[model samples]
Target: MRHSIAIVSLVLFVLSMALLLTLAKQAYIPRKEVRDLAKIYLNTTYNPWNKKFTAMSPEGVTAIVWDYRGLDTVFETAVFYLAIIGSIALARGIGKYSKPTSDEKKLGLSLIVKTVTRITTVSIIAVAVSIALHGHLTPGGGFQGGATAAVAPLLILIAFSQYFLLERGVSKDLMLVIRSLGLAGIGLTAIAAYFIGVAMNKYAFVLQNQAKPLSEVSIPAYIDGQLISGTLWFFNISEFFAVMAGFTIVLILLVIPERAFKSSGGEEK
Candidate 1:
């Protein structure tokens, strides 16, 4: 039976590899240019001069994410927020974990590793912030930047103990607060136009921008003579904090020991 299973597995793996190769080869075959929904997005997304609907962002992906398909992105962020909250709740329920004491936690790496990580951590964080801030004009955005920033905490965890982070005033509770605040910011940004219009007795739809009729609410695209792409920048900024906090909370929960959970009676009765 073991021999037959191994033979079958081998055959399946080989067939899968062949299928992948065939698909890859087919992908290289050139096809004629076809006008489609994608072409519409590509054509209109980057036009700052066009007066109809101005995203004011050269990065098509950013425009699509924050302007064209903003509601979808907002819901996606909400889903992600819920998922992170669920993970933390589940972790807490399964194990009433607390931050491990310095002595209880594993010792960090050697001096050399610590030194390198310390230097790189700052650089990594700076780059991540740049990516998040410039998301409107560039290829990167909030999610990408936040995920990249998360590496800083992880690296700190590796080179310096979690206790060290806690000592520096980083905590799960703090992260949760920050995450909540970021989500709130996103929600407020989405509705600001609508509510303002309502107060002023003007016609405005939810999530409407300055480009839309009767909506006076708009974020400035230029700040101090620099183009920031308005609401896109705000969205990117909010998502950056939300994502970073969510990941940080998860990481902190993961590193706590099983014994801590037991002490707190986290196991199901």
Candidate 2:
């Protein structure tokens, strides 16, 4: 009798949940459409002649990504870099010189693994660069590109053992420099924006009109004489470097064996 009661109760509970979900979806789907359409109308048509930006601008999303909400993205990028750095630092402290089986038995890896890694590294590097450069025009931006680029070195370490990668060349310090330089470039771009006197929304860098701003930095865009604010691209470069450095640091620290750092006394070296 108790088992039967429990089963009946379970069935009722599931039925109730399903009914509630159905009712909520029926209400929400239309409401969501209405709200989204309202928002689109407000942003696009609210200010029709936003200094040559029409409702038909193809770079509309790009403008919003950098100009409308760039501060948030900048902070988010900073947090991501910080988290990656913190994780790598923590891992490095715990395993400065541990030995891995791969390190000890480098001969065991197949030729296919070696060949694939080589090919993957080059391809990933190219893709990363492409993504970073075309970020303004396409879907992938600095962060995505940088993360992709970070994978190439990681692939090398995985395919050729940490010892081989570390000893033969490609030091962590060198990668760090490359990553830091990218971050620095981003910082400088922000500084440039602040100094250029048009960091806000009132004045745009370009438009359908041929009128150029009085500012010194104007790189031509695809829309005829349309150009992009150089500061936006600068920040993108910064983001790219920060991500690349953070990821590279994490990969190097994690892949190498803790035994590699051990002293003669068997303590971590």
Write model 2 residue lDDT over 211-231, tens digit each, in one string: 233543333233454433334
Candidate 2 clashes between residue pairs 3 or more apart in a chain or in different chains: 97-258, 97-259, 97-260, 97-261, 98-257, 98-258, 98-259, 99-259, 261-269, 262-269
Q: What's the count of clashing pairs in each model shown?
A: 0, 10
Q: Residue 52 in candidate 2 has what lDDT?
A: 35
Candidate 1: which pairs clash?
A: none
The worst-scoring run of ten residues by lDDT in candidate 1 lies at 96-105
User: Which runs of model 2 end up more than 4 angstroms from their true locations?
Assistant: 1-20, 24-27, 30-49, 52-62, 92-108, 198-229, 261-269
- TM-score (all chains, Cα) for each model: 0.82, 0.68
RMSD of each: 4.5, 6.6
Q: Rate the local accuracy (lDDT) of all candidates.
A: 0.82, 0.61
Q: What is the lDDT of candidate 1?
A: 0.82
Give the residue spans of candidate 1 off by over 4 A: 1-34, 93-106, 213-218, 265-269
lDDT of 1 by residue, 119-206 (tens): 9999999999999998977779999999999989989987887777988889999998999898988888788777777787877766
In TM-score terms, which candidate is top?
Answer: 1
